[model samples]
Target: MRTLALRGGARVAVVEAEWTDAFGVVTRGRVQLELRDGEPGPVLERDAGFWLRGTGVRALRNPGRRTARVRIVTPRTRTVTCPLPNTWRNEMSSMNDSGVVARTSHTSRLRGLAGIGFIAALAAMVATTLAAALARAVGVDFEIPDGGETIPLPGFAVVTGFFSVVGIVIAAALLRWSARPAERFVWTAVSLTAISLVPPLLSGAATATITALLGLHLVPAAVMIPTLARSLRTRTD
Candidate 1:
């Protein structure tokens, strides 16, 4: 195992071989993965990861001005333990970290995708509660209880949990079967969010109520799409 760091603005060329690995975690700034065919692969935000395998990719380039760090392993069978600087070390660790062969992204991206999406959805749910509180504190009493006469905090949470799980299920399914999971996820999420707005729109609430509901409609999507997309970012780490 060898560690390789790319300083800001540095670029690396891919070598031809049966299989080669350059595992990278964003140590400081962003790094853009580019294919030889000139496609945008992934954006490694701080602590985000990506990989360069075989000669499929043309080069790894530092898109940001700040230093970008990466590690390389000569033999793909060695166990790797180090984490990307600021991300969850244990959680972000991958199958490759155990020195085992893993399937390509084309075969499936869902193995870990659901967990990531769920975490993001959890965050979004909490954010919704805060947003509601903030709105009420400012005297924007835009509450419209469709399910009951009382504000169901537990019910809200349950619904959030359910929708989040739905997002995860969709992600996992697409990754296992679809070649373009990110793109597919984005469209699906957008369509679902739009469809969800219909119920709230016709609930006969005030305009402000409708506006607030729309905001709520987009909350899950705000979290789910990015989470799914990040999960699709390939990494050998």
Candidate 2:
């Protein structure tokens, strides 16, 4: 019997010599399987049992911002202990000093993400507002037929900020549970941005209004998506 501990964002290659016939059970946090071709496989949550033999799994990765452990059982009677590297040992020792270390580390990561999201939201708000003002200056009337009222400049900022925060929330959720968070976030954000264009087209507004609306929608999406995706990559990778 042995225990394999993985720190947050840690990846350990599977050595056939050592892992042969060894069965592993996840004891804490989440672990993502890395396939032979470097693609991601399924994530195993707590209490999940798995066998890596003949599975073509290249590595085990801890996807969450906390330590994860796996209990390994072999057919042999002798016990084995896999020692962590010095850096990992130091980290583990600090974590052992206080139970709150893991929680604090997780919270600190989220707080950094929140800071990045706030800056991106503010930039998006300013960008969309400026773009709207520019469109109006160029004779693109900010009218929507559904509301029968002109969309104000401040309205542009408000809408942009709201949607940007939504993107931030999505990014945070992905960071918490996803193995390839940045890639997934980009795909999701881009698809939603594409969907958002449909409403402006069906609004029965003039060509210029629809055009401006579509561009405005894209402006904020452009601002928020890359920013959040980059931040997620930095944190997860």
Candidate 3:
């Protein structure tokens, strides 16, 4: 058990104990908790609760008028694994399988990869919409040089194709070369989402640009996370 003292103007990053499951209670000071990004962390705050377990509450800081104190605890287990049923049987069958079965399974993986490509393409489309909304707000009258009139879907497709491939290249590098596919995918998604926001800032548009920009952020996050997570899944298992 460890005790923390938060002075009149002190802050601390909530930490875990030797055995993490021990839990915590805010005995004195106010503790504000939320997920933190690389910058400008979560806009909201949650109170202390049993969520100290698996919840990745990035930072906990003192937010009280007077001094406060907090108690900390640790979890009992370091790691846990869940085993699947009938997996050994499938492995045995694969050992006795021929080229035809092997080739088919490999093709299935590629098909899933293609679906991800389409999703990335869709992200590009939403990004373009956000770009337009932002451009209008800035009063710069921004548009593709030869955009002609109404926004073209093919143009979005072409742009989506390019960026989607770029995102794929990034995710593939981690999935193939890195040991932690899920971790790498999450970080990459965050970076890409932030990078996607830069264009709106550069746009001349102003009003509601933030709202439009946030909407656009969800588009790619929705597209990338699910597709990337699915790619890591094993259907044959």
The lDDT per prediction is 0.60, 0.80, 0.49
Model 1, runs deviating above 4 Å: 1-109, 142-148, 235-237
Q: What is the lDDT of residue 90 in candidate 3?
A: 50
lDDT of 2 by residue, 50-137 (tens): 6676667889998877889988777793754653345433443454211211112345668999999999999999999999999999
In model 2, pairs of residues that clash are none
Better of 1 and 3 by TM-score: 1
Instruction: Score candidate 1 by TM-score against the native.
Output: 0.51
lDDT of each residue in 23-112, candidate 1, tens digit only:
545555455566768875554555455555543666667754456675544446467576334433343355343232222343233556
Error of 2 at 159 (Å): 0.7
Query: Which has the greatest TM-score?
Result: 2
- The stretch of ten residues in a row with the least summed lDDT in candidate 2 is 96-105
TM-score of 2: 0.64
TM-score between model 3 and native: 0.39
Write candidate 3's Cα lDDT for 1-237 as tens digits. Answer: 555666644555546443144444455634445344523222111122222434455555554345556554334434424221254235324542111111123345446665675676676667666665565566533342343343343554455556667766666655443434446666777787788877756654443544554555566566666777567433211
Candidate numbers, best lDDT first, in rank order = 2, 1, 3
